[model samples]
Every structure is written in structure tokens, then in C-alpha cells.
Target chain A: AQSVTQLDSQVPVFEEAPVELRCNYSSSVSVYLFWYVQYPNQGLQLLLKYLSGSTLVKGINGFEAEFNKSQTSFHLRKPSVHISDTAEYFCAVSDRTSTDKLIFGTGTRLQVFP
Target chain B: EAGVAQSPRYKIIEKRQSVAFWCNPISGHATLYWYQQILGQGPKLLIQFQNNGVVDDSQLPKDRFSAERLKGVDSTLKIQPAKLEDSAVYLCASSSLQGGEQYFGPGTRLTVT
Candidate 1:
């Protein structure tokens, strides 16, 4: 079984400042990691995913995340956040050898202020 | 090119009432999924289908929830005798294949009063 943990429930950042949302997971086997962003009254949008290769993966909207195997972490980061970046972010995981059943963590709400 | 599609973007029903939601995956996608997202929480998988075959439904509350994907493209989810706890956003997502990046539709927000 695989489970994800997003440490912060809410993060407030100033516009143009950097931000990071922490996420950790527990799995007995290799896993696939993903980040999704949800705007008000909208569906989830894929930010990026880590299936293999380099630890750092970039996604749309100038967002990125790094997969740290040893730490069991996949933290999302943005060098400069915009006001439009304020939204709910989710961290999800799926076991590599198993099916594509994604297990998501409690979302982190990002509030980017001017 | 188009993303996953879902119908009746919002619904309201009394407890013990029944309701249903529908979904249409992106063209050529081979997998579909149903998830429940309660307020203040992340989405939880209720069921998964690969083409028209059931893949996993471990988290589904069998007594009240049921879902089906017919013809490998469209799907429906039903909840009978809905409970107050069933009030949440029901999300539908599809992927090109198993373990691939999924695209989601605007969920149906079910409010069971």
C-alpha cells in the first residue's frame, strides 16, 4: 500500500516570492509521484509527475517538484509565485508495480497575495 | 485534445434519496476512475476501470455506492439512499493507459442534505 502526507494545510506567500509545499510518502515498493493543482470550482490539473529518471521534474505554470527517494518525499516548488498561483495543491502516489490507483494527500491551500 | 467530460456539475438531494453522475473520458483513453473529495480533504479513489472491465473498487462503499463503465468510454456512478456523509465532490478522471498522467473533469458536487 502507498500513502501520501502533505505537511502544510495552508501556505500564504507574497506575490513574486518563492514557495515550497512539503509532501512525504510511505511505500514498500517503488512508486510514481504526481502533483495536481485545483482552482476554485474547477477540476484537478496535472502539474507534473515523477515516474523515473531525474529527481527534479517541471510542470506547467512555472511549478516544479523533486522526488527524493531516500527521504520518501516529493516537494513542490516555485521560484516566483503569481497571484494566479493561489489554489489548492494535491500530492498523489501510485505503486509502480501495481495499478494506477492514485492515493492522494490532504490538499495544501496556497494563497498568493499581492 | 479535449479533456475528460462530466455532466450535471452540481446536484442536491435529501438523505436516503438516490442520485447518479456521468462521465466521458478523453478520446482514445483506456482507463477511467471515480473519486470522492470531501471538503478539506484530497480526492479518494472509489473505483477504477480499464476499458469496460473492473480493475479495483476496494474503497467503494458497496452498500450505497455503485459504478459502471460501458463500451469502454463512458461511465456512470450511482449512490442509493445517500447519506449526509455522501455530500462531496465526485470527480471523474481518465488516463491514456494505466499508470499514466490523468486528466480530470469538473466534478459533480453532490450535496446530500
Candidate 2:
């Protein structure tokens, strides 16, 4: 069984400040990593994904993540955030074989203050 | 292209009542999935279907929950004698491939009082 762990439940930051949301996964087999953002009362939107190749993957909204194989972590980072960036971010993982079954972390709420 | 569509964005019912939610996946998509999201929690996969066939449903509670996808297009999820715990947002998603990037719907929020 695969699982994702997001150590931070909530992160508070001021506008224009950089932010990092940490994520760790436990999987014996190789896996694909993804980041999703959910706005209030809306469906989840894909932020970015790490399927293969470069460890550093860039995503929409100027967000990026690094897939660290040795550490089993895929952390989301943004050089600067805006007030509109406030939302709940989720980290998900699925094994290479069963990519349809996504295991998600608890989610970290990013609250951006003006 | 239209994304996944779910009907009755919000539903309210009493305990032990039955309720159903509908979903129409993106055109030409072959894979569909249903998930449950409780307040303050991440979405949990309840079932997955590939071209009208069940692929994975190990996490689904078969006793009170039933889902079907007809003609490899639209799908519906039903709950019989609903419990309070079933009061959560039911999300429907679809992907062109079995393991491709999934597109999610707005979800149907069910409240049981």
C-alpha cells in the first residue's frame, strides 16, 4: 500500500513571500507524484506532475516541485505567492503499475495574507 | 473540450434515506473514477471504471454503496439507507487513459441530518 504524508496542516505567509509545502510518500515500488490545488467550493486543479525525466518539474501558476528519489519526497515551492494563491494544496502519489489509484495526503491549507 | 460534469451540486437528506449522484465524463474518455471527500480531509477513491467495466473497487463499501457506468459514458453512484458518515462531497473524474491525468468535476455535496 502507498501513502502520502504532508507534515504541515496549514501554512501562513504574507503576499509576495515565498512558500514551500512539504510532502513525503511511502511506496515500495516506483511512483508518480502530483500536486493539486483546490479553491473554495471548486474542483481540484492540477498544479503540476512528475512522471519521468528531470527531477525539477515546473507547473502552472509559477509553481514547481522537485522529485527527490533518495528522500522519497516531492515538495512544492513558489518563489513568490499572491493573495489569490490561497487555497488547499494536496500531494498525491500512485505507483507506476497502478497509476489510476491515487493516494493523497491530508492536504495543507495555504493562507496568504495581504 | 468539456470537463467532467456532475449533477445536483448540493443535496440534503435525512439519515436512512437513499440518494444518487450522476456524472458525465469528458467526451471520448474511457476511464472514470469516483471519490469521497470529507470536510477538512483529502478526497478518497471509492471506485474506478474503464469503459463501463470495473477496474478497482476495493475501497468501496459494497453494503450500502453501488455504482454503475452505462455504455461507457455516463455514470451514477447510489447510496442506500445513507448514514451520517456518508455526508461528504462526492467527486467524479475522468481520464483519457487508464492512468492518465484525471480531470475532476465540481463535486456534489451531500448533507445528512
Candidate 3:
């Protein structure tokens, strides 16, 4: 079985400040990693994904994540955040050798303040 | 392109009552999925459909939950005699490929009183 863990439940940052949301996963086999953002009462939107390329992947909205295989982690990063960036973020994993069934972590609420 | 669509954006029912949710996937999507998200938790897969056939339903509660995708476009999920634990957001997602990125719909929030 595969599982995802988001180390922080909530992260608070001021506008124009850098932000990082931590995520870790446990899987017996290789996996695909993804980060998704959800606005209030809205569905999730893909931030970025790591399928089969470089260790560092850039995503929408100036977000990026690095897939660290040795650490079993895929942490989302943003050099700067805006007030509109306040949303709930999720980390998901899918088994590489098996079906593309997403296993998601609880979530991290990003509260960008002015 | 239009994303996945789900009906009954909000549903409230008493315990033991039944409820159903409808979803319409993207025009050419070949894969559809249903997920349940409890409060403060991430979404959990309930079932997966490839066209009109079931691809995965291991986590779905067979006794109380049932889902079907007819004509490989529209889908429906039903829960009979709903429980309090079933109160959560039910999301529908679709993808062009089995391993492709899924586009999610605004979930149906079901509240069982």
C-alpha cells in the first residue's frame, strides 16, 4: 500500500514571502508525485507533477517541487506568495508499476496574509 | 475544455436515507473516478471506470455504495441507508489516459443528519 504524509497542517506567510509545504510518501514500488491546489469550495487544480524526468519540476502559479527519491519526499516550493495564493494544498502519489490510482495526503492549508 | 461536472452540489439527509450523485466527464475522457473526502482529510478513491467498465472498486463499500457509468460518459453513484460517516464531499474526476492528469469537479457535499 502507498501513503502520503504532509508534515505541516497549516502554513502562514506574508505576501511576497517564500513558502514551502513539506510532503513525504511511503511506497513499496516506484511512484509518480503531484501537488494540487484547491481554492475555497472549489475542486483541486494541478500545481505540478513529477512523472519521469528531472528531479526538480516546475508547475503552474510559479510553484515548484523537487522529487527526492532517497528521502521519499516531494516538497512544494514558491519563491514568493501572494494574497490570492491562500488555499489548501495537497500532495498525491500514484504507483508507477501499477494503476494510476492517486493516494493523497491529508492537506496543508496555506494562509497568505497581507 | 469543460471540466468534470457533478450534480447535487449540496445534499442533506437523515440517517438511513438514500442519496445519489451524478457526474459528467469531459468530452473525450476515457477514464473516470469517484472519490470520498472526509472533513480535514484528503480524498479517498471509491471507484474507477474505464469507459463503461469497472477498472477498480476495491475501497468502495459494496453493501451501501454502488456506482455506474452508462454510455461511458455520464456516471452515477448511490448510497443506500447512508451513515453519518458517509457525510463528506464526493468528487468526480476524469482523465484522457489511465496515467494522465485528472481534472476534478466541484464536489457534491453530502451531509447526513
Candidate 4:
């Protein structure tokens, strides 16, 4: 079984400032990590994933996450946040065998303010 | 290619009433998933299907919720005797066999009163 945890339930950041959303996971077997974003009233959008190899993974809309095996973390970071970056973000984990049932953490709401 | 598609978009039903939501997955994607998302919470998988056969339904409320993917192309989820807690956004997602991102639909929002 795999479980994901997003430490912060909400994060506020000033526009043009950098931001990070922390995520951690626990799994008995090797796993895949993913970040998903949700606009108001819309379905989730895939941001990026760490399936294998590289510790750092870049995603759409100027977001990236680092997969840290030692720390059990996959934190998302952005160089600069925009007002449009306000959205709900989710962290998820899945096993590698490819049956691929994702276990998601309670979302973290990002509020980018001007 | 079109993303996963779900309907009716919104539904309002009284307590104990029955409701149903539908979904059509992306072309050639063999895995389909149904999830429930309450406000301020991440999605919880309600069921998963692999080409018309159920692979996981451990979290589903079998007494009140039932789902099917008869043709392996389109699927439907039915909730009988709806509860206030059952009111939430129902999401549908699909992933191709290649093993990567899962495409999602604009989920159906259900409100039970």
C-alpha cells in the first residue's frame, strides 16, 4: 500500500515570490510520485511525475518537484508565483507494477496574492 | 485527443433519492477510475475497472453505490438512497497502457439535500 501526505493545508504567497508545497509519502514497495492541480470546479490536471531516475522533475506552467528517497519527500516548487497560480494541489503515489491505483493526499490550497 | 468526458456536470437530489453519473474515457485507454472528492479533500477512489472488469472496489459503499463499464468504453455510477455525505464531485479519470499521467474529466457535482 502507498500513502501520500501534504503537510500544509493552505499556503499564501505574494505574487512574483517563490513558493513551495511540501509532500511526503510512505510505501512498502517502490513507488511513483505525482503532483496534480485543480482549478475551481474542474477536474485535476497533471503537473508532473517522478516515475524513475532523475530526482528533479519539471512540469507544465513553470512548476517542478524533487523526489527525495532519503527524506520520503516530493516537494513542488516554483521560481515565481502568479495570481493565476492560485489553485488546489494534490500529491499522489502509485506502485510501479503498473496496475497504478493512485493514493492521494488531502489537497493543499495555494493562494497567490498581489 | 479528447480528454475523459463526464456528465451531467451538476445534479441536485433529495435525501434517499437515487442519482446517476456517466463517463466516457479517452480512446484506447484500458484503465478507468471513479473517485469521490468532498470539499477541501483530495479524491478518494471509489472504483477501478480494467476493460469492463472491476479491478478494485474496496472503498465503494456497495449497499448504496454501484458502477459498471459494460462495453469498456463508457461507464456509469449509480447511487441509491443518497446521503448528505454522498454529495460531492465525482471524478472520472483514465490512463493509457504506457504508464504515465492520468487524464481527467470535468467531474459531476452532486448535491444531496
lDDT of each: 0.94, 0.96, 0.95, 0.92
lDDT of 2 by residue, A1-114 (tens): 899999999999999999999999999999999999999888889999999999999999999999999999999999999999999999999999989999999999999999
- TM-score per candidate for chain A alone: 0.98, 0.99, 0.97, 0.97
TM-score of each: 0.97, 0.98, 0.98, 0.96
How well docked is model 4, in DockQ terms? 0.68
Report the CAPRI category for model 4.
medium
Reference contacts recovered by each candidate, as fractions?
0.90, 0.73, 0.78, 0.73
What is the Cα-based lDDT of residue B106 in candidate 2?
A: 93
Task: Give candidate 2 regions above 4 Å deviation.
Answer: none
Which regions in candidate 3 have their CA more than 4 angstroms from the true location?
Answer: none
* Model 1 lDDT per residue over A36-63, tens place: 9999999999899999999999999999
Tens digit of lDDT per residue, candidate 4, span B6-94?
99999999999999999999999998999999987889989988889998899999999999999988999999989999989999999
B1-113 in candidate 1: lDDT tens per residue? 88889989999999999999999999999999999999999999999999999999999999999999879999999999899999999999999998777889999999988
B87: Cα error in model 2, Å:
1.2
User: What does DockQ give for each predicted structure?
Assistant: 0.83, 0.85, 0.81, 0.68
- Reference-based lDDT, residue B96, model 4: 81
- Minimum summed lDDT over a 10-residue window in model 2 chain B is located at B1-10
Candidate 4 scores an iRMS of: 1.9
Chain B structural similarity as TM-score, candidate 3: 0.98
Off by over 4 Å in 4: none
Cα-based lDDT at residue B13, candidate 4: 96
* Candidate 2: clashing pairs of residues: none
